[model samples]
Target: MPHDEAQARDTYACRLARSLHNQVSTLLGNRLAHLPGRTTPPKSVHTTQLKMALAETVFRKVYKLGLVPKIIAKLPVLSLMLAVISVCWLLILPMDGQFRHTYISENALMPGQVNLYFRETEWNHVRGFRDEAAKWDFESASRSNPQLEGWLSDFGLKVSHHHDPQTNLSTMYALMHAPRGDNTEAMVLVAPYFTSDGQKNVGAMALAPALARYFARMSIWSKNIIVVFPQNGHTALRRWVDAYHTTLDVTAGSLEAAIVMEYPSEIDNFSFMEIVYEGLNGQLPNLDLLNVATTIARHENMQVSVQGTAPQNLHKNDYWTRLEVLARGILKLAVTGVNGKLHGCEAFSGWQIQALTIKAVGTGGPDITQFGRIVDSSFRSVNNLLEKFHQSFFFYLLLSPTHFVSIGTYLPSAAVIALLFVVSSIYAIARGVSAADFVASIGSVLALFFGIEAICLVGAISLQHIAISGTESSGAFYVITAALMLFTVLSSVGIFAVKAPRFSRPTSFLLLAFALYFIAMLIVTLLIVHFALAFCIGISAFPLTLVQDLITKTHGNTLVSMKARVKVVLCLIASSPVTMIVLLGYILDGGKTEGVLGLVQGLLSSWHEMQSWTWFVVALGWLPAWISVVVVCAFGDFTSLEKEKTE
Candidate 1:
């Protein structure tokens, strides 16, 4: 067979007969052009080159797909970190307790370790001084007390006074120098108008402020003390903190703890006064400090508050019995929009500020001097040279005085959310969806994101409508629904258009992310109409973009399905009956701090729960929905490659 074929091909050589060969070759070329052959094909090119090119293209697509995973991985790390930081920030960060966290730039300003002997140095006069000081209100007391400045200046202090018109806030500030001879180091000091029922301690408004100014000098500490009355409210206080801190180094470092006095509302005095400490997100004090303060204040057994959870009348070891006011009074106010922090307003203004509200108690005990001495002592103790408070627990849960859960102890709550993202990411990468499918997914994400934004906005506007109509808004947020529908339509059309291929997908997504983040921050900033309401709103609105990228990308077809919609609605409905309704009703009640706290805690938990439920639907139900969508859109280049092959 081979011999016969060879003989025939040799006989039909193009070189042998040119004209005859040309006619046959032309016909052969025309017919064979559609066949995969090498006679007239691009033979000079390396198959390796073609292989490499195809491989490169495949790799590029793979690489592009990997970009999403790389970005997605960050979702877990950042989200977990943020939630963790928030928790840590709540603790050791300081609050209205036996002492607040005050910043000491220098290591030397020992506050109360001297032979000033304030204990035996006139315990009786605190009441008289306090009563006399109470005679004048904030304005009168401030006007009458110019010497307060001169006194700090006498201690070799450079002083500044801030007069805030908004919220009618005023403050007096001074920084003490290191001792002239020993010259330990520099520090700051501040004391502003203490206005409560137009009265001070007993006899201190006019004279005690002047003399109280002297206590900083007598401290014999190393660091300078910047005592300030950052008032006019939280805003003014926050402004002052910004100005003050700006005057210092502009870098990330530990801010020394701060102390703020709130004797404004002290009329007489009850038993041991309550020390209200609310760390950022239910953070508590350092265990060492807690123990020390408890042992020293004699009310070590007094109540404590972290976040809004304070155990009522908590007793530990039978000896150290501190009252844990379960019903958060002042701390609750700060958490639920009632900023009871005299100087706490400054913390939000970019000053890592915390405070301690130590007021005198016990019928008629611990006058201004004693209270001042206690503060001075605590500050002096802090002044003792030491590294940052990194050794103790930064994140912990308070069960009692001695028991606590460390950061290592309680990371599970945040970890659970992060884990879901991890699983979703792995699946998206392995599926190897095509570019068109990718665009479809992204379009869906865009719809979802804009849809969410529209819903939230409309609800906000409608709420405003009701607020103006009477004071409260009713019914579901209709505007949000309309916005969602409109955006969904827009997104769907945009993805389906002939122009979709023109724009660089990555660039578009990047630009969109930037625009959204900016818009979010702007909306948050604009809520300053009512500081309290603004704070509440700002928090509620600020963190949506936190893990949004992860959440949106995880949405396959299951999320947008009719069945999924039913589940989502059922979730919404079930949420109301079980917990959301109760919370919604409570919040609707208005101005109820306790109710609000309870509601918020529940709502937060509920929101988290809903996210988990959504994740479940996404992972389990999304496949079915995605398959259905792909089947329906098979001709549109949106089906899975395997499905296309099978068809």
Candidate 2:
């Protein structure tokens, strides 16, 4: 009975399986019959065909909905809007609650915890030294200064001088070994012989030695103190720093921090202290170091300023004041990064050493002794550190001395501006790809792109060589002239290249797209290391988005209208590298010809001496991009080229 029942169940299961198989086969056959070919596909090809059909259905639905192509078409307009929005976003960053209040992230940096003791005795010594230093010729007193070296030695320091054979400049430095700690780390006190503006730094020369004397009297220091008197300019100091890290005869220890004193004015008092913190290529010292100085100054009831913000306005902290301060900070950072003008402390950069300058502002306020106390307390706080400054913000935008916006808060603004170029690039690429001769157009465009870049690269190398060989005045002229000549050559190439019979409208579009994409990538990479520079360049180049290959069909014969000509002129005025440099020189240097020349010379010196990439980036990336835009605009209507061919 059981065997009969089992046989019945097995027969029912087999019947059900066959019924399901027949149903699936019938459905598949009907689906396949409706396919476009209407032929039985091999078993291996059947699944692929089904997947392709599904994808085609989805793509068709998406296309009918008009989403992607519509967005791509409007990308240029959207990009312009985004550029404006980016500026607005930056302005909004200074408002309350948008930025963070400055705080000491490292507990070891107890800035004002120590007692203040720098006083009248030290002030007397500083006065004496200042009077003596004022008598010496700072410019001619390079290789030997017996008076200054004698004073440093009197202060119980190991004094030595380093002379660079190439530049014929000299740097005299004195080291005070720490009595309480090991000689594995040291701090720097730099008193440049001349201010960044080429004025004598008499007060700083006196103050540095007097402070070293005071530091010698105290046994609380954990890091050895090195007093440096770099003659000629910041370059001398940079050379000294390089030698210290590499080949200096006298060794102290690894440099961990530096404080540059710039008391250019002869007066014993000042309005306020200006903290100069921008470093080479937009690098910054640890925020804790800046906060330490600020905190110590405030603790002593002295006014503090950053980025040249007036002391009176710093207390207001209103919307406009904050915005102005923010603008000044950004502009200063951009200028410092590009021009390589040293503000006394930027020389310590690129060596993993944190540094800044405290410059005495105006000629009336806190006595010089108070500034001494600020330095004294600051060094004392630094003495308390167990390790290097690692726990504070290194990348930040200062809204005020007491408030800041870090990278996470402010990077998006620059990123948004950079995105405009990317959007325009994408739109151009899409248009170019849809053309019938895409392969030929892309190949030619790439060749043109690389050709222009090659010219720029050669120009950059030539500029560097000129900078190295030429003097300050003549070097500036040579650099400017060389750059203009290169641009003219590039513009001529672009104009003539587009007029060739083989170069089509698609080629122009592709070339412009390639240039825009390169610029966007450059800005993106710069944002990581130099946010202010990236933002400045991105905003200045925003006009590139307006560039397009204007094509209009009129009757049978083709001609460029007045609008295209106007666009070319406008783009040259707004986006040309020459125009931008001239405007920046006028605005920042008060339109003085010498000031502009000095700026150019400074840029060259920075490139040659410190290996700053600003000149290279401008020469190679920015100039080429601008030339490509001009070329595309010069292309005009494609029908004109076709008519010429027929003729």
Candidate 3:
């Protein structure tokens, strides 16, 4: 038992260890293979080996998480937190005087620095135009337009008429070329002759032509001044602007800025002036333009209002009153779905020209002379600009005429709302769903999405056509029909939810969520591009994304319980596009000083034009999201369905 025997024993022990290690390795590998999503182990494996293999397999499976799902699971709360913070940011926009007071950003726009020279001569001309124009209403406006055109031509300026055959309306304008510059850039002064109510902006129309004549005499001008006497409302201005840019054979050059004057009364005195900057579909003028207008108004000792309400005083009670005024301004910009003539300034914004409306509001003794001086001074500031109004903020929310919130301060709310959908869609995708399944599910839903879009488009077209072709009496019925159709289309998603199989339901939910997320992204992109359109769409549609993931955690259950179903139903109802329309209609209508029926009539008018993106965004963007939520809620309980199928 000496050295030779010891060597033999050591060698035998080494060999035994090697053999055991190989056998254990093989068993573990075979067990792992037999686990779910792996190849099955051979039948020849013994119980001891199988047990060892099973233990190793369990260990591996427990720790082998896919990177995406693991990351998503860790970050589910982020979206919620962002959403909460975003909503809170909105509240903070007004709390404790958080909004910053506005000042001019462009050095060239030296607001309120110029002394206004519009005086008795201008007033006399305005009076003459007002008195001469007092006989004209909407019906007679077209007939009298030639006379106005001739009068504008008498100022030795180039005059033109823009007529839209569809509405049988005419817009008359006169251009006075700049004596100093090449006339490559121009500024427009729009004076709507008729109000949306078919009355005349008597004072403004008179004032613009007089200003044009006065401006034509000034040899110091560096940009052409175009005086627009709009025959209709925003519609005619849109037409004229379109003609100047694309349709008409005229060289009006790039529009630098615009001023819209609406003085509907013959009193020649207004207590306050409302600065209407919110444009068509939420377009806004440059902050510089607003600042210029406000500065001039203030200099003239004129009380200024943003969206038509001026805080009477800064007293403690009036602080909340100011807040209400601010909220109204924000909401008006947020809900720019309607077409009113006073918003002609908004149409100019779409063409990249900064514009705003100076409407003389309230009755008696602010003096049209003061209003004219405000316009004169504001125009002088724009005339000083060497380039476009790009130096100042193109996106802002006016709290008062003097206070505002820029994009950086107020954008987080919309961004957070859009981002929630983004995070949720990513979370859904990360939930172990196969890429092919995701792709196939998305493809299926795309078909459904486009089909739904087609149906909606046809319905919209039919309603629009019916409204146009029918008499005034039938307009209400057609509008009601359109509203009902929209509701039905949105609510119909519940039908598919109740019918979709449990197996594919989660994937379907993911697809729909992704579609919704994409829509949100589009809205965000649009917000970046055009804040008003995007903001309105985002706010209206954002609530639909707030619903709990209806199909997400229902792994064992296919159908939700009756209680859960009720909650889902209620949520769907609350966030439905139809409901949003009604709520928005109420809010807008309330602001209109019109009752509920008035809102209905406005909605009908909006629907009839089919030009307003307000209804379409609701029907298309918000409707699909609503439908997706309903479908997810209606999904059968996959766990129970699978069990039933297997049985």
Candidate 4:
């Protein structure tokens, strides 16, 4: 109705009001500013200010990686990540690898040389020594072998001797200290016995004197040699070695290889001798160096046996041969158990010591001095080492005389089980999970751990008492039983009492671990004689979560608290994947191991002789797929739900 100017002014005012409304809405959530409907663009910063701000922002984010709530608090992504990690074991890997690694770099080897006539010629010296040793009437060598040290001292060795007659049941020890003021990088142990009257003794005590005489007279070795005359096997030998190690300046590297001669009647060092590399698990020595020695031995016409490869398989690289070795080596030797001293002490050399024994049972080969030179040469070869095999694989299994599968190739064995950890954690954080459910779930995990312990102990006992009675039959059984019972009782009581007192906590844990071992022994003992394997199976099946949770939670950590929840989810999901396999195992009723053990078995079955590349494929391929299933199933919609809640 007004003039045209009035109409224009009115329209302009309306626009101004709307602008003010937007500004207010943005500035004060739509209540304070007049420009409520407006969205103001941010003011530009100067170049200097912008750069400074960006740098500061980056620093802040990085600094908070360990401290911020979001790092551990980001549940959805973490849950998904964990889930994928748990299920990857279902994938398959190539089981057949060309027995040996063709990829091992060979530039550093001194591979082909033979002919140690010096060793073969030592037979005459050995015979005179053995016959004299047989004539002496023997007592516990521990009580009477001091003169042997004087004889060794004359041969240019610093002899430090020990005799623990009462404690060791008369076993003697003569430690030949590595000679100083020389490049003493090797040692040879002569196990010939002392001559005595038609001696009646336990495990042949007089044999040591003969060994002393045989080695002291040998002149074929260029390396420093320890011509030892121990009272008996392992016990006396370990003590002598221990004493020698202590007296010598251990900070300096000395003493290269050790050779123990067990043959009593042999008068000669024959052609090349057979090499026995004993034990499978942690006790096994480095193989590259070993292979090199074997090559040399064969070149010298000496045979190599893993352990008395009876009626020997000359073509040892066959699949079954390799599989049996890998399976038993990984599962049996890797397991923690009481062991014989020879294999046990061999572990000290970081898996490098080899034992060469020449027996008179149809095998005509290398004798004492021939064996000595080989020991000397082998050590000299090892001394040539510039490093501790850091670049090569640390864990591996030999499938054949020439074949090997590395730890990288075998990781699925562990990864499959490790995934279960993540699965269990995811389950704990699932929407409906509560403390009660957590405990119940955790209990099952505990049950599995206990069950596995029970099984392993029982299996070991059965293997001892039933399958094959080992060297120390009665003592091993009794020791094992006592150990299990003690371990269990301590673990239960200690773990349950996490809050007894600050100082007492560690005490409790120690007591508990011991108790767990004892409890294991008792359960194994009470188990029906025939059900030993079941006991072993049950113990292996048990989850480590109970112990993990106890330790992790007792420490009281935000990171661990979150991880605890994650462990629950993983344990839960582990059930589904584990279910079918368990049902199948029960149905089959044979060699039924569970949890980490099943995955271990699965991996062994699939990749007994897998190559390096095959291992890589299995780890990546299997780990991701299984982990993916865990993510989708357990972590479903968590991110979206969070975003919706935030919105």
- Candidates in order have lDDT scores of 0.38, 0.76, 0.65, 0.38
Give candidate 1's error at residue 514 in angstroms: 17
- Top TM-score hit: 2
Task: Give per-residue lDDT, candidate 4, residue 124.
Answer: 54
Question: Per-residue lDDT tens digits of candidate 3, residues 2-96?
Answer: 24423332343344344555676886676656667635544654565667767656544433432323455444577767667865776677665
Evaluated at residue 118, the lDDT of candidate 1 is: 52
**Tens digit of lDDT per residue, candidate 2, span 592-632?**
66556655666656766765667777878888888777666
Candidate 2: residue 42 lDDT (0-100) = 69
The top-ranked prediction according to lDDT is 2
- Which of the two, 3 or 4, has more lDDT? 3
The digit string of per-residue lDDT tens for model 4 on 1-647 reads 12442333233334434444444335443232444455752343234345555655554444333222233234335434543442232112224633345233433545544344444344454454445444554454345655555555555455544545423533333433333324445444545342111213211222333444444454443444445555444344444454455653332235444555444333443332334443322344455555665666555566555433433654455555655555434333322121221322232232244433332222355545544444445544544454443434434555544567655454443443333334334322332223354454444434534454455445433433331333324454345433533443343233323333332222222222322233334324322321212222222333332332323242345786456545544443342223323343333334443233332232222222111121222223222222232222222221111111110
Question: Which residue segments of model 4 deviate by more than 4 Å?
Answer: 1-95, 102-115, 136-139, 146-156, 164-223, 247-253, 261-284, 335-337, 341-373, 383-393, 428-432, 435-539, 542-647
The C-alpha local distance difference test score for the whole of candidate 1 amounts to 0.38
Give a tens-digit lDDT track for model 1, residues 1-647: 12432233223221223333345446545544655756655543445346545655654554444443344445545545644553443332222342222222233333333444555345454555555555545565453356455655665656666654433545666655445323333323233454222233332232234434455447355555556554332444554665454643322233455554445544433334334333333334444444333334542223332322323343332212212321122224324212222334223222333343444333444344544554555655655655433435433434333344444433333332233323333333323333454555566545544554455456434433432343122222233223433443343223323312333333233323432333334323322221222222223322323322222222245544434333333322231211222343244445453443333332222212111121122112221222222111211222112212110
Judge candidate 3 at residue 170 and give its lDDT: 73
Give the range of the ten consecutive residues with the poorest summed lDDT in model 4. 638-647
Candidate 2 vs 3: which has more TM-score: 2
What's the C-alpha lDDT at position 22 in model 4? 49
Worst 10 residues of 2 by lDDT: 638-647
Name the runs in model 3 displaced over 4 angstroms: 1-81, 96-98, 196-198, 310-326, 337-342, 426-445, 460-503, 532-560, 591-616, 635-647
For all the candidates, what are their Cα RMSDs to the real structure?
16.0, 12.1, 11.9, 17.1
